[model samples]
Target: MPYVFVGSVIVGPLLGEDAVFGSLTAQLAAFAVGLPLAAITALFPLTRPMSVAAVRALCDVPGESLADGPARSRTARGRTVTWFTLHLGFGGIISGMSLALPPFAGVLIALPFAAALRGSRVGMPEVFGEGWLLALSPVIGFASLVALAGCAAGAGTLLARWAPELLGPTPADRLAAAEQRAADLAVRNRLARELHDSVGHALSAVTLQASAARRVLDKDPEFVREALTAIEETTRRTVGELDAVLGVLREGDQTAPTAPAPTLAADLDGLLKRTRAGGLRVRSAVELGPQGPDALPPMVSREAYRIVQESLSNALRHAGPDATAALRIALDGTDLEILAQNPLPATGAASRRGGGHGLRGITDRARLLGGTAEAGPVDGTWRLRVRLPLKGPHDHDHDPKKPQKPQKPQKPKESA
Candidate 1:
């Protein structure tokens, strides 16, 4: 406020007629006034955050208004102009006028003293016998000063509240910001799903293979060698997939290497082999009757591979040591059906301890490809079934003799 008063004092005299003589001088004076005002007007928007910091420091209050200072919209530039005009133009004028009030009161209080000093030379009669008016001058001046302070505080508080409403972002800007945040959240969720599928499957495979190798290290050296080989291959593949996913997150580096997408027809056999080597008895069959990998889109193929991989990993981790897991893939018309079933163990604690992300990841992948998935225990066997549309919307009749579709394969739903 004092700074504002000082600016008022500095600017008030420059606007007087005596400061300018000719038209040239008048223009120069106008420029002098405009230059500082223009600078303040242009810089206030950029300096709003700094101003917030200053206000916080002065008020000793960590207000919510300060936190929202940085979110001003592109459309609030006009508000900055209005704020500058009010703060500097009217604000300075008001300060100058208020500052004049106290001095005017003092001048009024000094009038009787001047009159008495003059009356002493002319021998004029004393209007007040006890000189009460002279004594009241100090009291009046103190009252004026107190009023000034009260008004200053009130005005400052009002301006503080009013500035943010005008200078901050509009409702549209806030809506845009919310939508941007939602988009960012969706991307992060997709990345998390990818990481969970790829890394989780690899880790599950490593655990199973390591345990099998340790158990058969002396009795079956050949089996142990195969287990070690499987472990190495899984780790390397996981690292490559991790690098590919992380590469997408790198900023300003378009040349980063990315792993190519894996196809269901090519990668499914390798996935089954790894699971078999991990120690569970596995039987797999693929009947791509009409549509092959070329017929399916790349996205669908990759998601299908992940779904099978996750399903196999879950079976290896959950199904008992002697349990036989069966996997079947068949294309019926324009729909691809995938099913995996294994005998449920008497003790279900092992599956619960594995964190239960495999089925959820599979559901997310299938849903992303516009498909359906269902997984649960049915007739004493844990079953996972998914039916994805290869072409657009089309009905494909499933022959129960081939493999009973598990519970009609409900549409994929997001997990909480």
Candidate 2:
């Protein structure tokens, strides 16, 4: 609507006498050329930033686009067409009336005054003898134009105020934005969990080893040397894990190493050895059925290793100096069971029921792999047990050519 008014105002002066006194064909031709341009101006989709600037320029108010994308629905397109048509029609009417009426009224008064000067028409001399009214015609026309300009400005302001609501993001765009936010949040949460499990375990081990080394510095030289070596090894491994986690967030780093992660099934013995080196007595038994450790998927192996690592760190942190930990890994059919148990301190059942982030991490890791984990005091011993399902829902079709082998369950053999 405002566009129509502004266009008519600018084009009115250019039309001159033809706007008011031209033939019907001339008026039709003028309108035919102007209307389409008005429609294009109103219906065109501007970029969001440009639209904001235009709205502020037109109505002196801030504006936002209704749709983020260039695509618009049929209903929205229909509404825009209707608005532009009404705006152009109404503005043309107002502008034409203002321009035509003032001049027509001026001529009506001026004609009598002109006739009075010539002393030719009836009653002309009685109304105006001097031509003073003729001089005021130009002033009246100017005032009428000023009044039309003011009206158009007010209407444009109102239109700008309503623009943002009509123009802002559609429902689909909003949904896509929300989904993107959720995905980003999930990534950040997974990174936080990984960092907490990896770095926390390493720090706990280092603290225990360093404290033990310091205590035995004067009493046992050999044990002190072993503790220092374990501390150094733990620090180096922690640094590597930290690099792996951080590399995931780096962008455009083509030189970074792409190495496979170490798994619990393959590195179980090394982990147990490290725990023993930290002055804890650990007895471990690993028994893989017919499929062996290779049967376990990479993701499952990595998570399993983290659970065991955190559990061992917890045992070292909470259990007494004489605590002897037992670890059992057994694969029976399509399930892998990991059980770690340590003798609780003499401080009753309360000491056995220790709670911390390590326990929560173990539970989360197992649950994520479609497995179950239980941790608490079981018959005077602190125990952490996790059972994971090896066969996924689509595992049967994963390698259809491989023939199945009948297997028998074997008891896990204990070793010191």
Candidate 3:
């Protein structure tokens, strides 16, 4: 119905009378004229972008001879040439209507051309497409109407003293765009916070443990044992968390939950297995003492594992292909001391820049979780230490006051 009115607007000008019957006849003629031209223009690739070699070669022919002969005889000379002439003539007529029609009539002619352009671009065939697209040709014509309206409005604004009503609805579009941008910023900030909290914490712990594992691999088997064990436990936890995060990235019907959440109890065994798979040898001695039942909180457990995983991944990236790592986790009352140490590559330039993210990510996680993470060299060895409160000094205190108690750090178990 709306389309019929738009068509009438285009032909209504061609009709001398303003009567309903005359307007209907005008609309019929507009449809009769616009459809065949749109069809011909879309069939021929008239635009520079889509014109291929063969089409270009066809277009090189001289004059209107392609259209002068019968369709049967001309097709052999070139389909593209015939189509090109047809579109050239058709486009000229549309351009003439655009120049001559009132704003409303111009809209009716412009819309269908735009629709045809869109259809051709997407490779949709025009063999039997009728109704809406055919009917909407006048809407394409209407865009010229809008261009004219804009020019008139601008001219009026410049001459506002003569016509004050020309300023139009100027503020609405600007306000909507501002609101949309603000919404986008809010979402980005939240994503940054989540990454800082999770991935960051894991990387830091892994770095520390890997350094420890490398130091004792040959000189002290018992010490190497602890580091290797920690590496495995850490890697497993990291993989699980990574899977969770990636699952969220996938778009589909929600998946059924898979592996259960990382348990609060120390399950560094899973972490150790994964690190081993990545080609890092682990020497670990991890014991969740009698108070071990008091297990690390779920957030701490997952983070602890991530710390291990990222450190080992870094080790693989930085450490020599045959590098070994050590890990040690011990409970001293309410404080959990995690130490991951790896040998400084014989050359000293071992995994310099490569290990930083795991270090930084772990540091961010530790800080957020009411803990402190630190990394770097000590006595020719690379170490990562993350001190997190298991329970706390005050129930809601900002900082806990505990003297850093050094442990009787043991040796790693010799590889069988």
Sorted by TM-score (best first), the order is 1, 2, 3
For candidate 1, write residues 1-416 as lDDT tens digits.
Answer: 44433444455566664433234445344544654565454455465565456556654444554334443555565555554455454455446448566775665456466655424553333543247865665576667777777777766676666666655556765776679889888678777877877888888889988988898799999988888998999888788888766755763486766776456856766777777877777887766633444445556677788888888888877897877898887776667899988888888654342246667777777776678898887777888899887754221322225542332332332111
Highest-scoring model, TM-score? 1
Give the clash count for each candidate. Answer: 0, 6, 63
Each candidate structure's TM-score, on Cα atoms with residue i matched to residue i, is 0.69, 0.66, 0.39
Write model 3 residue lDDT over 57-175, tens digit each, in one string.
43343221222211222222244343334434344445444555574454346435555543555443474257686576566556667766665554433332211111111234234
List of clashing residue pairs for candidate 1: none
lDDT of 2 by residue, 153-261 (tens): 7667656655555445557557776898897886776677678777887787788888888988999999898898898888887788887777656534878774345
Give candidate 2's TM-score.
Answer: 0.66
- Model 2, residue 20: displacement in angstroms? 17
Tell me how far the alpha carbon of residue 317 in candidate 3 is from the true structure, in angstroms, after superposition.
3.8
Candidate number of the best lDDT: 2
Q: 1 or 2: which has the higher lDDT?
A: 2
